[model samples]
Target: MIFPKILRLDKAILATGIMAVLTASAVGTAEPQLPALPQAVSSFGATVCDGYLYVYGGHAGKTHSYDTRSVLGSFHRLKLSAPERWEELPGGPIAQGLNLVSHKGKVYRVGGMQPRNAPGEAADNHSLAEAARFDPVKRQWEELPPLPAGRSSHDVVVARDLLVVVGGWQLRGRSHMPLWHESTLVADLKEQPWKWQAIPQPFRRRALAAAAIGQKVYVVGGLSPDGPEPRLDILDLARRQWSRGPDLPGKERAAFAPAACVLNGQLIVATNEGVLYRLLPEGKEWEKVGQASRKRQVARLLPWDEHAVLLLGGAGGGQNHDSLEIIPIPPRPEPTPEAR
Candidate 1:
């Protein structure tokens, strides 16, 4: 993958000055400092449920190829406050690729492919429709109704109690097909007997990232048409409409997963390239928040109390990194009280 060149020092300096003035003035008076990214334990595709951070999937061991060939479906949860140590939640019967979402204190492990157990079976033969949910409190895994199609490399986001899944691709020998076009599943976890609804997008996409703001769900850049993927779409849940958001600021790339969360009523997104950004309502453009100390992917943001956020997991490449980083989600400045 080709990374875009870093901004020149002079350009960066000028940009910083402009950003400082714009951000402070826009948010209200005081200049809010972007929280410092904390030390991490390299890992990726982790989910934050309740107040704990749960990490699962991603590559393991030294050998890169081994990640796809030999990944462990182990789950670990970390308390956001106080005792910061990893506690194993539960392990699955098979290793899963990155695709996890949380709803109502439970984690839903969506579609992903694992290696075939037997020799005759092709390596790409592992497509799973079996949905699994982890009850963090009980530290147990229970199977749920399977998806319509077994797939991997898809993205899922929980919005308004509904788990919306998009993208996903299927492999046939060395080639693959769009998993998005066929059928999209939306599960309302709160409803009794849990029902799955089907929604369709104009095109097929895989490795796409998503986040919800109010009633709008932003489907950011992802891998489609094979090469680097670029195009950010939005689905308005309230109006049941699909529109577009600003394109990603950087180069187009795939295989990299994005972590998204709402901070102070604003949506913040982080990618594997260590780039961090925030999206405000101003023309739907993304503003660079800050960069992580190291390159990470599939990292999710978690609110630590009301003052900070944690970056969990080290995803992207075929390696398991056990890093947990934190940053302060500075409070929105208070407006000036009117003179009595």
Candidate 2:
């Protein structure tokens, strides 16, 4: 994929200064630093539910370096109100390239990629179709209906008890090739015996971000075989229709592994370039809301409160970060009265 060009020394210096000032204005005052992840990771599953932040399996090694010890199954959660520490929680398989979602008070984890080779051996990765839900009251994972087929690098969202999985590819290991998926998998969580139903998706892409606003699912950019894309596809559950929306704002680099979530009835997205944007109510354009202090790709963006979000655990500055940045949401621009 063609990413945005790296800034030169002079431009980098100027940008850093502006970022500091903007971050200061956004923060407003000194606040206690929140807890960081127990380890630096990326491509993990993360979400917020019932005043707690939960994270699950992620990649812990260098780029393209995978092993038994490197891919982590570790899971953790932080009580948002107390904000003192990240409590250890029950974890599942050594996997990556998935998303964690919250529905009611339970959190769900879907498909991901698992590596079976040793550190120095050739890659032997397998895409998984496993699905499970966590019970905070009992503190364990309960089995759920798995996907129809193996998939990974996809995103999941919970809306109206419907568990939706979208945009991932299937890894068939080193000897075989990977295949991009062209359909979306959905399961009704409230049903007694959960069964996955496949619905046709218009596009085939992985590493995309998915968010729900009302009954619609917004699919944002990711790397396609055609390379980086900024296209936005919207799925209306009511009509079961797929239509194009506004492209993501800023450089296409932002399109690759962008962070997205719903907050304050708005779809907020942050890019690898640190630019923050939101979908206007009209849904015709994306507005520049603000930016992040640290720019990271594939970070988890989840609602922290009514006015802020937690951007957690992604690769940045050539290294993985364990830091969690609190980004304050900017108010929408007032609508201009039409001139008569």
Candidate lDDT values, in order: 0.61, 0.85
Q: Write the per-residue lDDT of candidate 1 for residues 1-340, one digit (tens) a residue.
A: 2224334447777687776666455545543222222223232356667866666665453422433435566666666553445676567745444567788888888767565534333344355677888887677888888777676667777777888877676543224543344555688888766767876675577666776665567777666665655567777665666777677778666225666666665666777677777665553677776666666664566544444456765554555455556554444443111100
Best by TM-score: 2
Residue 34 error for model 1, in Å?
A: 19
TM-score against native, each model: 0.75, 0.89
Q: Would you list the clashing residue pairs of candidate 2?
A: none
* Model 2 vs. true fold: TM: 0.89
Q: How far is candidate 1 from the true structure (C-alpha RMSD, Å)?
A: 8.8
Candidate 2 per-residue C-alpha lDDT over 1-340 given as tens digits, one digit per residue, 9 for 90 to 100: 2234434447877687776676566667434589889899999999888888899989888976877788899899988778899899889899999999998899999989999999899989999988998999999999887888889999999867888999999998999999999998888888978888888999999989999877788899998988888999998887888999899977776799988988767888888888878888778899887678888887889876656777889887877889898877776543211100
Instruction: Give the per-residue Cα lDDT of candidate 1 at 214.
Output: 55
Error of 1 at 57 (Å): 2.7
Instruction: Give stretches of model 1 more than 4 Å off.
Output: 1-44, 61-69, 117-122, 172-182, 254-256, 305-308, 315-320, 328-340
